[model samples]
Target: MEAALTGSLLSLSNNLDTQAKAAQKDSQALRNISYGILASDKPSDFRESLDNVKSGLEYTTQYNQQFIDTLKEIEKNENVDLSKEIDKVKAANNRINESLRLVNQLSNALKNGSSGTAEATKLLDQLSKLDSSLSSFRDYVKKDLNSSLVSISQRIMDELNKGQTALSNVQSKLNTIDQVINSGQAILKNGKTRIDRLQTVLPSIEQQYISAVKNAQANFPKVKSDVAKAANFVRNDLPQLEQRLTNATASVNKNLPTLLNGYDQAVGLLNKNQPQAKKALSDLADFAQNKLPDVEKDLKKANKIFKKLDKDDAVDKLIDTLKNDLKKQAGIIANPINKKTVDVFPVKDYGSGMTPFYTALSVWVGALLMVSLLTVDNKHKSLESVLTTRQVFLGKAGFFIMLGMLQALIVSVGDLLILKAGVESPVLFVLITIFCSIIFNSIVYTCVSLLGNPGKAIAIVLLVLQIAGGGGTFPIQTTPQFFQNISPYLPFTYAIDSLRETVGGIVPEILITKLIILTLFGIGFFVVGLILKPVTDPLMKRVSEKVDQSNVTE
Candidate 1:
């Protein structure tokens, strides 16, 4: 069966490629004729184009017929609808014929001395209609019919492939059947051997039958006496007994009606109730046909609802998920992850939580402002002559540190007093702010003292980076990986951490660690400021003098 189906599919798929190419040729011819008709300007050219269009229409009709026949064949063999794809072709053909008639009428009028611009205009209009008809016809042939044939051919090929797979399966099943046949043959051979043994015993069985018959013949005389006795009894005695039994049956038959009179009335009553039973059966049938499906669906829906709220266990799950509040049940379902967030030192509000980052930022900005606006090393020539370089450096650095500490004190105190920020330990918050500010100013001051204005630019750059990379506005890990990696090293990272501890509620060990880190940064930068100044000062002074020549103040 599979092989037969495969052959049929292959035959159907065959010549599909050739049919596709023929369709392409007809489509291209139609388009070419359309273009020629549209381009025609002269009456003679229009006449030639109309003739071409009539020919193309004839060709289209024939081409459509071929495909229709193929589709008819498919519909006959397969469960598919051969759609009315030829309607467009037929319409186009009708339109083309009408256009040809119009063109001929115009041409004959011009030839018979009806020549004028109006006549020419009528000719162009008829040709335009012809071109439009042919263009639509071309698309139907080129795109729709070609694609249809390709898809049909592809379906045939797919069926053929499936048939090939089925054929392999059939062959394997045939092999199994052959094995069964072989087993049956072996069983038949065994049966034949048993039949031969039975034939060998058949003569002895016949001899025993003959002996038994002789033995019976010997008892025939005695048997005849017994039969004669039985016959005598039957002829005389049996008739009298049968007549007695018949007399008894007649007597019973006479009295049976009286005995069964109540039974007869009961049967009549039951027979009268048969219509009600029939009506009930009909109603049951109607219910099965019409109402049972809806009833069954409702039962299934009820079962589903019951499954979710079945018993105590289901109720417990619902209560647990809803936290015993039915109002919050939908909200719980919307966000199912029961995230138990635990903030160790929770602050009062967003402002309170953000106080640390902004506080740290204020002090850093304050330090940057001081260094950018204030002179770090007082380079006055008279003061340089009067005071040693160390005294000048210490005086300026001390002044910057003092103002930076003052900036920290104002910011930290204002956070507690004005903002009423949730500062758990106001004293530690103030202390950490002052200490962080000292470090910030020292770093900026040292950079400017050693590197001149370049150091001031470094301070601004650090501010931008810390504002982003510091675990201040957002956690460091949420920032870019670059920020997260360098966060531990940024001065503002530890500064913000220390201030946060005080604002939210201080963790003594963590607060100490952060403050120690801040102190280390301060001491390190302070040492660099005092030590690197003597070395960088004179060299920067000469570079500064050259820059003074350029008149751009550092």
Candidate 2:
């Protein structure tokens, strides 16, 4: 009977050991499952993880119940003090049940997108208590239970601690997500308010912009037309009037004294040879007395008119009246003149004053063509050869000089053939044309040879300046002070003066002086080209190479 009892006790002990190992394996699997659920990030993964946790908890409960049954059997057979152990097992089971309830509540809160701070706090408190209870149970098992059961309780306590930490981390993440959600909602509300305000004011803002645009469109053309008219009057008409007034004043001053002397001589002759021609003498004296005074008065009035036209206020008022008149006429009528005059010329169909200006322009244009079209050097030749930079300058100039002369010849002869230009001295006209062409060609060639492409640009600028300042079409004095000051220096000034003398009727002494001045201009440019080109050519070459490399890289 004693042997049988010992065998039964040993068998129960062996069964308990086997169950403890199995429970340990199940607890480890439950720990792994709980870890996986905590690790899950996505909503779907969380749902699946929760389902798996529920399944794992159920398996853990079954293992716990099995252990409890085994303990009850031992208690009944062995008659040991197992009541305290049973109570601890029941308490552990209750703690696990509470944990499962808390986990379920957390899962439901997460599914509904709530942070579940209150539920999570409660769960953390419960988990903390359960951890302490499990630790106590582990200590109790180590003292009262066998080694295998003690190890299993220790592992269960460790897994519960891990699960508690994971739950705390999850709660922290959810709290952060909730804060972000609240901030986003506030930002969206503010944006919606601003957008609503913008919508309310949009029509008024659009209408204001549209009205501004309409006003600009309606008024701009008239403003632009007025500006253009003012510009034309200042640039063209005003200068022409000033020039005409100046010439008229000069003519009156020169002729008036001669006319007065001729009247006095005629009156003296009539007085000395009277009685036979009394009525004629009487009529002559009456004519001088009445007509001469009237003529002087008219001259004074003319001077005042010219002076008024020069004033800014008078010009502005005239422009305003003319613009109004133009509006009434629909731009069809010509500008009105305050007075009219008759021309008393010795010859009929005298050539236009613009003829000399046009001739000078034609010569300069031909020089421009020569410099632009022709290269300054023989690229086939080396710089170190017999031909120096100065020689090259002279060679190129000589070629262009001839070309300029030929161009002048063609233009001058063409004017006679085509326009029947009424030139007083055709030979002198051709000679002056050639001289003007040479001077123009030399100036242009010197600029290009010394400065390269930049020199060409300088030549173009000079051409524009000359056109404005040369007193070709208008008197130089009528232009801006800068142009008037620069006028004596311009080649076109001398050229036009020479050409006008030839066309009108040349004075030998005046023509000779103008020709000498033109010669001096040509010599000056030639000397500059000879002196400056060598210094500039190498620098231009370096600049060209750099530009070419940059262009290639681009």
Candidate 3:
């Protein structure tokens, strides 16, 4: 029993250590992502990062609660020291029997005519001592140990209950937020549809106005000629005819130009304002269709997390933050700008902003393809005779890194030659792409090497996340909170940022920072691969064996 108890403790301890390490890794990822958020100019990204932080906190809380539960179970276990209690009871029984035997000896001595002897007195004293010892043992069990156990158990239960209550409160708040988002989205969707229809018919309406003005101008000459002939026929009132004719001609000149000029001005104003109106409507639609839904999804995720946690100030704070951000976003969408006029400097290349994003995406996609096609392990060699796991990982990593660099070169050079990306610093552009490739390949390679097929799935998921959250295409702030929160953790964010710097015009400090971040990401994933491969390899092997067995059965 003791051995089993010790083993359970050891297993729990190991589980805790693993959980702690996982949490630490998550913390570092969150920190890195937070930094990415700070670097971003978009509010959407910042809000999204906050959501990720909340999720991490909730997970950490659940882990801590698991530790608490383990401790509580250990404390509440009545059988934990049952063996010790049995041993105490047995010692007391032996003493009681010895006392009874001594009493019998005294009786036998009295019957044998030795009642006044020292032996009888000694037996009485021994009996007295045994009685005292048994009483002490009984008191220890009933009074001291029992009370202590009860007190410990009660304390653990009290704390656990408190935690559960806190979590429940947080869950309720999140549900409320979800409902609010749903309502807001429905309202915005209707508004966007209406705006779209209005924009679609606006050009036809303008054309009708132009046709009416032109027809009026074409008939004005005949009306003036008819009036002049009337004045010639009315020679009896020459002065009045001259005055009337002058007045009529003056009215035509004034009214015709006014109508034509008004039409031209209206057309010009509509042409200038149409794009801004469309942009405002698009922004609102994006918020309703994309941003709000994402926020709600994140809230639901957070709600799931809170379901496992205790009610605490942290949960309250998280809910409040989410609510405030959602309210702000609602306001922005509701009060969208119809037209905004601002002075701006125009860049020669309109695509410069997006070039970095596409370049990074191409390089990442290339690495993903490379890893998917290639095997990380050598199947020919027996497991015992093969290279160390680290060696296999590093070896495969080196090959993938080279391939990634080549892919980067091909894509980057192609962008310059064919796409005319008009990169300001061609050398820096290629260098950034190479660095991005290394980072992307490292992440994909690490996953595949350590986790096998499941790792590949994770890599694919990561790619999808980065594409959405990386701020590569649209501003991260313009995206949903979940993507915004995850963008900083994604390598694509730094890669694209660095690429954009190279394409637009490099800021040496910013460029250096981005490059350093990308390098860290590569190093971080490589380290994860090194640490987790040995641990996960056996599991993967077991799964493979299970699959093979199932296939044979089929």
Candidate 4:
């Protein structure tokens, strides 16, 4: 038992590592593609692109090794399960899906000239071929009676070989694209050098013009100077000299614009040519295949070992183990399942707490407080002297609504005090929080008017519900379908969503909707409460009797 547990733990650990590596590689590949596709703008995004590419590659290799290792382990087992094999196949398919997703992302980045379009496009094509081949091959293997173990092994081997060939061809295509990107980068650098040189000359030309102007002025006769001196300077020396400097400066300025334009045109041409090269790589990768020789060899071995078992039951057990291993691997590709139940705990309203928590609390607290304060006596009411049924019900609703507003003010003030630190959308955030509080107040009041103390129990129920549907942490959609469907009906849910948006830089429309809903709920409850007040006399008497017993006991 201990050994089996150890094996399971080890397997899980490897699976986790594989996933982490795959994620890293996917991110790196994205960065590399960005660099290749957007060669012109690579200087700015180059670091990110490169980092993503390297990380993605590392992760992919790590994940692939783990997968292969797991497969080998399952192959070695004497008793294999068909279900386990199916699971493993599914896991492999999931890995393939991830690869495909990464490829697609890279292709998009390339098409948009992100970083490494050619390489990304090629990788995408290779991934596509691998997916198609695997899909068909897995189906063939599942048919069980397609051929003898040797024949099936041969077929798988051939398919895997095709896949590896595709991988090789894709690598070649990426190399060509890389060359074009490097060449383009070189040309871009040259253009920058030329532009820089021209920029350096500009200030000198301006200075030269200033000097010529000063010399022309100094040559001119002053008010006290002779007429002949002034005339000589003006006609022969100053006019000619001033014109020379002015003409030189103007000529330089005029040529600068044209020179810059030409440089820009050249850079644009290079960028355009780069894309064509990237496309060529993508086309080449499309022609390649994705095959695994190891996989085929392992399959052959497993099948041969299975055939040697004389008893059908022993063969079945072996087959079951194989199938189980395969299925387990496949299941790993999907989102990790959370078997742990939701742990309900007290949520602290730390100023940094998400909008939903505050909004929901505000609404529920306000409604109940307002209603309780308005109708219920501070001291105990007994059989000897009890508040009228009408007073108790309507009064509680009114008091809670008012209390709700006061609570809203307190929270809003708190927000204002810390708004600078974190509250991004002050107006929207406060409004939504207040809106939710009012709605919660209204809903609680309505429930109390109908069921009295039993309604307080209903508030508790709402609290549990809000925790699940509030989208405070777990997104409502990811929960059970019933919660997902019913979430919108709860005012706290909308309020929380709205407040979260406001705080998190997402402006939600639910705040306004909450207000509308709250108003409607308030009106409906008020009307219902008035209608029920006369009929609920008997229930009110019983409540008074309970109140007397409590007071007497105290």
CA lDDT, every prediction? 0.69, 0.69, 0.66, 0.57
lDDT of 3: 0.66
Q: How many residue pairs clash in each candidate?
A: 0, 0, 8, 79
Q: Which candidate do you rate higher for lDDT, 2 or 3?
A: 2
Which TM-score value belongs to model 4? Answer: 0.32
Instruction: State the lDDT of candidate 2 residue by residue for 1-554, as single tens digits.
Output: 22333343344445444433444443444344444444545433454555565665556556667667656654543245566667777776677677778778867877787654555567666666766666666555545554434443344234334544434443454445434444767757655654443344223234433444454554456556655665666688767888999999999999999999999999999888886588788889998998989999999999999887887588777677777786745443554434566543222244545778889999888887777788876575556587877777778888999999999999899877788887777888887888888889999888877776787888888889989998987888899999999988888888898888877776789878888988899899888778878888788779868878888632
Q: Which regions of candidate 2 fall more than 4 Å away from where they truly are?
A: 1-351, 382-384, 552-554
lDDT of 4 by residue, 318-401 (tens): 567767797664664463474767634322344555545754675576565555545432244473256665666566656666
Per TM-score, the best of the predicted structures is 1
lDDT comparison, 1 vs 4, better candidate: 1
lDDT of 1 at 105: 64
Backbone clashes, candidate 1: 0
Summarize candidate 1's per-residue lDDT along 156-226 as a digit string, tens digits.
Answer: 44544454443444345444543544476875765565344324422333343344445456555755665
Superposition error at 394 for model 2 (Å): 1.4
Best-to-worst ranking by TM-score: 1, 3, 2, 4
Flag regions of model 3 displaced more than 4 Å: 1-347, 382-386, 552-554
Cα miss at 470, model 4 (Å)? 2.1
Worst 10 residues of 4 by lDDT: 144-153
Q: Candidate 4 at 529: error in angstroms?
A: 2.2
Among all windows of 10 consecutive residues in model 1, the one with the lowest summed lDDT is: 197-206
**Candidate 2 clashes between residue pairs 3 or more apart in a chain or in different chains:** none
User: What TM-score does each of the candidates earn?
Assistant: 0.40, 0.37, 0.38, 0.32
